[model samples]
Target: MTSASLGMAHTSSQAAILDVIRAAGTISRVELTRATGLTGATISTVVRRLINEGLVLEVGRAESTGGKPRMLLQLDPTARFAIGVHLDHAGITYVVSNLGGAIVTRWRQPGAGSDSPAEVVARIVREIGGMIARTGIDRSRVLGLGVVSPGPITAAVGMVLTPPSMESWTEYPLAEALEDGVGVPVLLDNDATASAVGEYWAGGIEPTSAFAALYMGTGIGAGVLVNGTVYRGASSNSGEIGHICVDIDGPPCWCGSRGCVEILAGPAAVVTAARAAGLDVGPAERSVAESFAAVARAALRGEPTAAAILQRSARYLAVAAHTLANIMDLDLVVLTGPSFALAGSLYLPAVEDLLSTAFFARQSHPVRVTISTNASDSAAVGAAALVLQSELAPRQSGARLQAELGPEPVPAQGRTSVVGSLG
Candidate 1:
């Protein structure tokens, strides 16, 4: 075999082994051999390489099966670190996590309201430095920076396409700017996809055959995970549940669609409905997070109008969930993001009820819908998970894989629907 082929084969094998070890929590070399279908000698060689790289460590001895007790191998959670940045108009959330996707440090700041691209990039670089210093993590041990933003992105170009929620960030070179500024590799993915990955790594949703993460912020989107990896459609913008038409002639969305889930059920839509019902949603200048919380609070307090508005939003979200479950045949739906922090109590049972009753394969396989306990920071944590995924798993789906391995590495604006994903 050729030298290049040999190198790629070794890398792939090593990565696969590391992933198994990670998923297993603590495993012995014999168990790895059994799981990987690799020879004992090959497992030994790869495990040795990983140990030398500081990626894996020998924790202790496992129970003896027959011969001498085998040594247990596990990932060195502190061996490397990654940073995740969630960029939105309301605010920016930064998370620094170890190799095992444990948060070591975190910071939250006002987002790029009207700042230039350069200014946003500079702020990210400075904060990244601060996080490393505060956590006492050596700069060289940091893997890379992963930035999650409202999407309609061209991941290959590392650009954030014009997501309506953030008008000032049209076609911005976010990944490149951050990579150059921070002096580390940068990966830019939509918040939904990152959230799904985070759910898998940190939220204990791994080994699942298929599931979807519904990220509800100012807008809503989904991250489809089929076989433990994100299903990024043609343009790396697959999961725009927000733009799905739930009502034929309901409300006009900013995406030029009628009755999109975003227009009918997103935080903005809920707040608007609350306002129309004479509920106090505070001033328009306040952040989406705050206004959404206010509406949720009013509903929780049993205000009839506010409760009715929230019910309507929940119904629309159920439409989205039903649609996704029928099409993707998903086994699970995780409702997450900042908007769900307060309103999830309202959305959970409503959507779950709809799915149980209306899903196409409900009789054959019941689809489970649950709310993320980490709704407020799942995206940021997921962004950190993205770095872990990129390094360890290197997703074979999405424009990212195509960009890295396809014939040409140019960005393509491949659209899957009337509008692309919004976060």
Candidate 2:
């Protein structure tokens, strides 16, 4: 952020070094050299540049092996900052995270509801301004903003593939609109992928870990991370787990698939089942998110009907999770998103049980399942990490984070194109 005093790393080698130090928590120069398989001279040179740039700090010292104590180094948590916002029909979440992926500020706001794209954009701009002012962090320290939502983001057609409750946003030039209003670079991503990166960036998962972030908001999706990089499949649509068919003869899905996890076990399905079971989930006028939350709360409160419906959905979800794990051979699967925040207690065990018992790799290495520490705000936190990742850790996936939002949606008449590729 302080380019004159703390120039940003410009090479993959430098990014790799920063990532290693951050992931290690603290490592000596010798360890970095060994870990990276780089020459001592190269490690020294890169670490020196990082130290000079204020990205790395020489911490105390490590035990010596019949020699002088080795100096240890670490990422400076306060060195830089980034913003993340998760846009969903349930609620909008905002978070500010430092270089170490520690969230410094967070808040929530009403979902888009029936608001127009322009109005929502204005509110997002206003909310970010207030949030930054409240945190009191220097603007110069912030790398930029990252925004996540459901996909496939057919920006070319000006709409989310599965439209969030904010149907009016179907034709919005979201990235360009936000950047213009916020006066900062804005990157876009799907919530599931953002959650995956958020977990990796937070250093909870190992740097080379292979994991999937199973996110459930208004809809369900998953994001996979291989090593530390997002395993974006061809066309950046690697984690559309919601479309995985769990039952061949079940209900139809908008994705043109019969018995997809989305149609059979997503929040809408859960809520619909609840109502059909003669349970009072919520008011008819309430949002689908609200209805689903009612069911979750009731299930937690020992309502037999609600629990039955929710557990059924959880089982369907687990079926999908099992399928995904088998295909990816993942080491971990994290349940995250606003919906999970409300009923993860019910879903966690279902997913865990299935993976532990049915995962193909169970005989070799047991798969792990856990809820995201920032579950309710996982997407937003990940979005914030997007800025940090783009600038510091970059990516081995070829495209920089800022340019990885699939395609730039065609902007409305009189407006610039949505931010992607061209940006």
Candidate 3:
């Protein structure tokens, strides 16, 4: 092989080694060599390079088998940082994480309803700066930002096309705008995909696990994962489950469809149902999130009307889950996002019981349905994990778009130094 090809191969191996070390949390050189199936010499070389790059740190020694104690190495959480921003119609979730996907800082702010797209971009840039300052992380060590928005996204263009509920952001160049404003390569994906990636990074699911993360935010979507990689359908909107027609005669959805799961079973639908059932869901002007929370609280307190409304929604979700399970033959279904934080208990059992008893693969295998273990800020965490995944294990998340489209052009005013390219 040519020297250049060998060098490229070495770089790929190094990335793989870095991913393994990050996954292992803390591992010795021998274990790394075993995990990567690389020669001890190659492992030593890669470890030395990573150490020099400040990406890996040598911690205390591990117990020796026979000879002297073996040195333990781990990803230096301080070596690099990533920012994740989750944009919603109601609020924004921003999280800063290290290379290990640990949340060093997290913030929640007003949503797009409070500001225009341009204003939101400016706010994100300013907030990101403050987060870095507060965390005392060097600017250069910050990798890049991953922005997760409601989808039907044209992933190739980083455009957020007509999302169901976030209509004000129609056809917005959110990724480009944020990149120009922040001077960081920005990755854009749907909430479902981000939450699924978060699940992968959280390490509860196995590497080869096939599961679906059904993200319930203002709208609903699915992130399908097969063998650890999200199955981004053509146009990267694979998980728009909310638009799946669960009832042909159901209410009209903002997506211009009738009887979409979103229109029938989304938070709005649930809140509406509760209100129609004579449950005092506060004032009609209350935000959908607040109304949904009220309904969930009532349901948890055994209000029959509220419980019945959520059950109806869960039944529709079960229909969607059945279709997803059959199509993907998934082993698990994870309900994630801020909406689920309050009402997952009501959704989980209904979906789980339906799938377990009547799923397409029921006779063959049971499809487990559960809420995300990290439900508090999964989308934000997933957004940060997107950066870690793109930088250290790009292949796993299929984040090679930058190589295809080239670096995004950074605007002039308020231009900051570019972190490593991630788009």
User: What do the candidate models score in CA lDDT, each in turn?
Assistant: 0.77, 0.79, 0.77
Candidate number with greatest TM-score: 1
- The Cα error of candidate 3 at residue 14, in Å, is 2.0
TM-score of 2: 0.89
lDDT of 2 by residue, 213-304 (tens): 99998788998987676777765667888998877898878777789898888999999999999988778888888899999999999999
Which model is ahead, 2 or 3, in terms of TM-score?
A: 3
Backbone collisions counted per model: 1, 1, 0
Model 1, position 138, has a per-residue lDDT of: 82
What lDDT tens digits, residue by residue, belong to model 1 across residues 120-180?
8798789888878888988777777778887676544544455565776777667667766
Off by more than 4 A, model 1: 1-11, 156-161, 398-402, 406-423
Clashes of 2: 1
lDDT of predicted model 1: 0.77
| Candidates by TM-score, descending order | 1, 3, 2
Candidate 3 local lDDT, residue 323: 83
Give the Cα error of residue 338 in candidate 2, in Å.
1.6
* TM of each candidate vs. truth: 0.91, 0.89, 0.90
Candidate 3 ranges with C-alpha deviation above 4 Å? 1-11, 155-160, 403-423
